[model samples]
Target: MSTQDPQPESTGSIRRVESSTAASGSSVEETPPSTETTESSSRQSLFAEEELSVLRLRWDEVQSGFVDDPRECVQKADGLVSDVVDRLTTGFSEARSRLEEQWARGEEGSTEDLRLALKRYREFFQRLLAL
Candidate 1:
């Protein structure tokens, strides 16, 4: 007697899928991982660094002018303002240093140093704008 079993035909209407219960559990339908987003973010950081450097240079120039003529009348008003500016500048510089140190330590992501750095940067910009 013949003992061959009949094979099932593939139906075009319903496709066969790998069941999750199968060997590898489930087939991962992978979309392409993105590097473009990371590249753009890096570019943005570089741009911000460049722009901040320019602003720092400009601040230095403005500060130098304020000290060029140290007359009694001008000194009276300028001295207090200069002191405030100096404090802000120093704070900003300290924040930048801490941020750089943290980044060097590979703590760039979700760090307090980054937050402090951004905050100080804003303060520096505001001070510059006030001038």
Candidate 2:
């Protein structure tokens, strides 16, 4: 099996959140691994360390702009957050694929994968709010 699972289609969940943020933020911008979304909840595809590092760096770039460009910072933050949500969504799907493959092979599927994804989701939620 391929180590890389194909990324899924962008169903409207991210857009639904983006639309809500638009109503609130671009006017007011904000982001999800919504527990309400079964796909996000079903499995954990943890970010590889390199991916997490890049995200952290992107976040730093957004945050560092606050003094000179608060509005731009907000916009950039919105973009960065949406990117992270997309990554998480991909991660969840990859984990689900791995779990299913493991199951078929008679190996244990780690709930810890899902657990970590949930943790990242929670962090994403809290960070979006804090921004």
Candidate 3:
């Protein structure tokens, strides 16, 4: 019924879902990683193990409920996905903030740039007035 081979988890941080579980959308709980993942290279940036487990349980409930109310199940899945996205983006947002701070040292100094530009403009104006 399927042609896809079971693939290993690319990042140590994210748990790999079984081929069956992924396809059927049942038992979406992530299995323990076969090998330890590096923290810096973790696929999931923000969610801790406990939080991921909770999300898996909640997702299982959402999938199981499809038999009763498909519409509600879809809505719940949407919410869960949205929550994960928010968590992921929060990591990026924080990293960007830190980078901005680091760049303030000289990499991206708008203050100095503005000062230089203003001085150049004054010199250009004075030269034009002389002409």
Candidate 4:
């Protein structure tokens, strides 16, 4: 009997994978993300550049202190993680609140805008799940 792996399937604009079985070996093909997807992903940064820089600096300090004080380093790392999570939660909450306010004011967003918002949410949710 012969067995072969399932072929990769294309899904949306983010990923496209193709595979073929040949006499000698199998080959896989990857499709680059579309320009729109690339631009949107770049714009989806959760933190501003300055905020990210500060977080990276704090992380470096925590990592460097680990050899001298492991426990303190762990505690500091935990606190930093908590702060990042809180900031992300707050950002999402504020965005949702703004959308709710618009709806309450009878200001409906365009269908395309709403679709894009939902797509972003789904992508974020998927990334969280992956982590």
What is the TM-score of each predicted model, taking all chains together? 0.35, 0.39, 0.46, 0.64
Which portions of model 4 miss their true places by more than 4 Å? 1-44
Which candidate gets the maximum lDDT versus the true structure?
Answer: 4
What C-alpha lDDT does candidate 4 achieve relative to the native structure? 0.53
Candidate 2: minimum summed lDDT over ten consecutive residues — where?
A: 12-21
- Put down candidate 2 lDDT per residue, 1-131, tens digits, no spaces: 12232122233122111111112222111234354443442332244445545556667788889999999999998887676667656655665676688889998645544444344455545544643
Candidate 1 per-residue lDDT, tens place, 9-107, comes to 111111111122322323332342145532332223211334345444544555456566646435544554464345444544554676678779987
The top-ranked prediction according to TM-score is 4
> Relative to the unseen true structure, what is the C-alpha lDDT of residue 90 in candidate 4, on a scale of 0 to 100?
64
**Pairs with backbone N, CA or C atoms under 3 Å apart (clashes), candidate 2:** 25-28, 25-29
**TM-score ranking of the models:** 4, 3, 2, 1
- Can you write out model 4's per-residue Cα lDDT over 1-131, one digit (the tens) per residue? 00111111111022211112222222221344355654454344444445555667777888789999999999998887776666666656666787899899999966644544565565556446534
lDDT tens digits, residue span 21-129, model 3:
2223323224432323222123222334655556667778898899999999999988876766565445435545655776877676454333433333333333335
Model 3 steric clash pairs: none
Clashes of each: 0, 2, 0, 0
Candidate number with the higher TM-score (2 or 3): 3
User: What does candidate 4 score in Cα RMSD to the true structure?
Assistant: 14.9
- The true-versus-predicted C-alpha distance at residue 91 of model 4, in Å, is 0.7
